[model samples]
Target: MYKNIKVIAFDADDTLWVNETYFREAEHQFAKLLAKYETENKIDQELFRKEIENLAYYGYGVKGFILSMIECALELSNYKINPKTIEAILNIGKKMLNEPIELLDGIEEVLSSLQDRFKLIVATKGDLLDQERKLEKSNLLNYFHHIEVMSDKKEKDYKKLIKHLDIHPSEFLMIGNSLKSDVLPLIEIGASAIHIPFHTTWAHEEISEEASNNFKYHTVANIKDVLRLF
Candidate 1:
């Protein structure tokens, strides 16, 4: 299946190290901070809405998420949120940025095994500085030929990356956790993709089953499982 795939791209966040888990933790903390203003359920829903709405302006990553939390807190509080509470919300983002990189089991093994055979790169969407910091901390940087911190993961974005690599879509393969960002777009562009779902996913990244059933891609239960496909 991979015979024509010369360039293999992997998502950076949940696929390489623990990411969505931290976002979940931050969301829980955000809900607690605004408990008096609104119910947890309401806060959670509104924050998600705010994040999606802000994506165009802030793009993705911890910074955008922090702004969304603050916006949600302000609206839920009727613009009466405490300054210290705002400070605490920022701290949530800081903590996430500082969290230790917990590499998923079998990531290195897969990278190591594939590095010798394929041109590997990190095809992900997030703040460039934060993504670079994580890669540096991951100690997995050397294994990859390039790191692509994308603004968004759409069909055009993947097409641009493929064009930059001077490779055909058929020779490009993507592996990541989010089907919306990683799998479906590649399929649409005539590229191969493997879906390795993380236990957690952002609401924006989730897709309907019917939306994905039409696409042809391999969904593996674990990262190591991808090796067998090669």
Candidate 2:
């Protein structure tokens, strides 16, 4: 079914491997820090909701996430947490830079299989350095002919990517975890999109529904299963 697609762009992070799990763990630590000032459940719930709101304003990236964490820390602690406490939380986020690299199951094999017929691309958004490092460490970098590390994934970004690739939207396919950031924008530009839900999703990425027929929103259980389509 995917044989006719010329360019298949994949989202990194949760779509490629484990990412939301790391963020969830970090948020748990932040909740612990708030225990003295507020109930853990209240703190966690508020932070989770606020994080989603922050994403709408700042979008996704390490810097925005750090800011959200700072905001949550301050609010949950009733504004008593000092700069040092904030800095410590920020440091915890920075340490994610060195997190171990591991690809989703069958990612390697599927990339290998698709390489023969499709032009593979990695289209991910985040802090440039961290995203680049994760790609490099995964050893999956070699498979993609192009890499798009963006601060945001708006429709314009998709247009630019298509223009740069010199391919029409109909010939391109975007595979990702987030309907907000990945699928919707690309589909609006007439490209096909595939949605593969990660086990643990970022608060900002939760979508109301998958795309309807107008966008060709295919669904998959996991990244590895993409091979079956090809």
Question: Which candidate ranks first by TM-score, i.e. highest?
Answer: 1
User: What does candidate 2 score in Cα RMSD to the true structure?
Assistant: 2.4
- Flag clash pairs in model 2: none
**Lowest summed lDDT window (length 10), candidate 1:** 34-43
RMSD values for the candidates in order, in angstroms, are 0.7, 2.4
Q: Clashing residue pairs, candidate 1?
A: none
Off by over 4 Å in 1: none
Clashing pairs counted in every model: 0, 0
